[model samples]
Target: MFVKICSKSELPEGGVFRFDPETAEKAIVVCNEGGEYYAIGDKCSHGNWSLAEGLLENCHLECVLHGSSFNLKTGWPDKRPATKPVKVFTVKVEGDDILVDIESGVLLEKPDA
Candidate 1:
């Protein structure tokens, strides 16, 4: 099933919302870059820092903690100190609402934290 994380208006034109599910500390970030919206795991592979607090550009997410950049579309770490990828979710836009499917793992996932 898909989870209704947030509405389109709740996010800024180029901002991200850090989501931490109550059921599990498994967090993710819902990003809105202009009209393109995406969801990715909040955790950074390099460290415990969350990607939601980073900057977004060209569909890439930059980790502020260590300057590691990740492709927001694929969650693939593009820069150093982070060779692994983070989890990515399937995002859908429906009538100003953004939906996320955590099961797809389009962003990837770590089996053992």
Candidate 2:
């Protein structure tokens, strides 16, 4: 099922929002890149750092601790220090609401451990 995380107005262009659902095990990071919405796992694949605390340039989110940049569209890390990709979730904008399908999260690469 899709959950309403925030309104479109709340997240301006090139903005990021972190949502932690009480029912979920991991938090989600919602990003607005040039008016497009993308959702991915909040934690950095290489470290326990929060992706929301990192920088967003183009469609990639860079981890502040290790400088590992992950593509928001595919969840694959483009920079080094990170081998595994983070989970990506389906995002949909309905009217003024931004919804995320937490149940449909997919990890592009499996973790080694």
Candidate 3:
């Protein structure tokens, strides 16, 4: 089931809302751009830094620890230092609420060799 992460008003345009759920140790962030909302893991795959402290432009999330970049849509790292991809959660906007399905679980998987 989806959980209400934050409200549409809480996240400013081109800004991010970092969510630390009371039940989960994992950190997630909701990014808003031009009224579009995207969710991704807050930890950087490179050095495990907080992506919430990193730079965000358009749909690109740059790691604060390293210069690695990830696609907000796919969570795939676009640079070095971060070979693994971060998790991207599904977000839905209903009226004034922004909900996320943390239970549905969005994780990175290894490719079959």
Candidate 4:
């Protein structure tokens, strides 16, 4: 099921927005760039750090704690210290609401911490 995250206005282009919808298993980091939105596991696989706190350069989200980087689109890590991939959710825009469906097309459960 899809859950409303937030208004599209709250998510600006070229930035990241963290949302915790009622249906979410945990907080999710939503990336907004060029009128597109992407959702992925919020917590980092390597250090348990919040991925929203990391920097978003293009499709890569860099972990601030250990300099690990993950590709937002595929949840693939581009550097050392993070071997496991994260769970990615599908994002859809319905009117003014940004909806995320974790159960629709999400990746398998994240690796153990």
TM-score of each: 0.86, 0.91, 0.85, 0.84
lDDT of each: 0.80, 0.89, 0.79, 0.79
List model 1 lDDT by residue over 15-67, tens digit each: 88887776323788889877788888888888988888789888888899999
For candidate 1, list the clashing residue pairs, or say none.
Answer: 87-107, 88-107, 88-108
lDDT of 2 at 25: 49
TM-score, cand. 3: 0.85
Q: How many clashes (backbone atoms < 3 Å, residues ≥3 apart in a chain or on different chains) does model 2 have?
A: 0
- In angstroms, the error of model 2 at 62 is 0.9
- Lowest-scoring 10 consecutive residues by lDDT in candidate 1? 104-113
After superposition, the stretches of candidate 1 with alpha carbons farther than 4 Å from their true spots are 23-25, 107-113
Model 2 residue 79 lDDT?
70
Which tens-of-lDDT digit does each residue in 38-112 have in candidate 4?
Answer: 888888778768888887887888889988887777887878798887778899999998899866545554444
Better of 3 and 4 by TM-score: 3
Clashes of 3: 0
Top lDDT prediction, candidate number: 2
Candidate 1's TM-score reads 0.86
Considering lDDT, which of the candidate structures 2 and 3 is the better prediction for this target?
2
lDDT of 1: 0.80
Worst 10 residues of 2 by lDDT: 104-113
Each candidate structure's count of clashing pairs: 3, 0, 0, 0
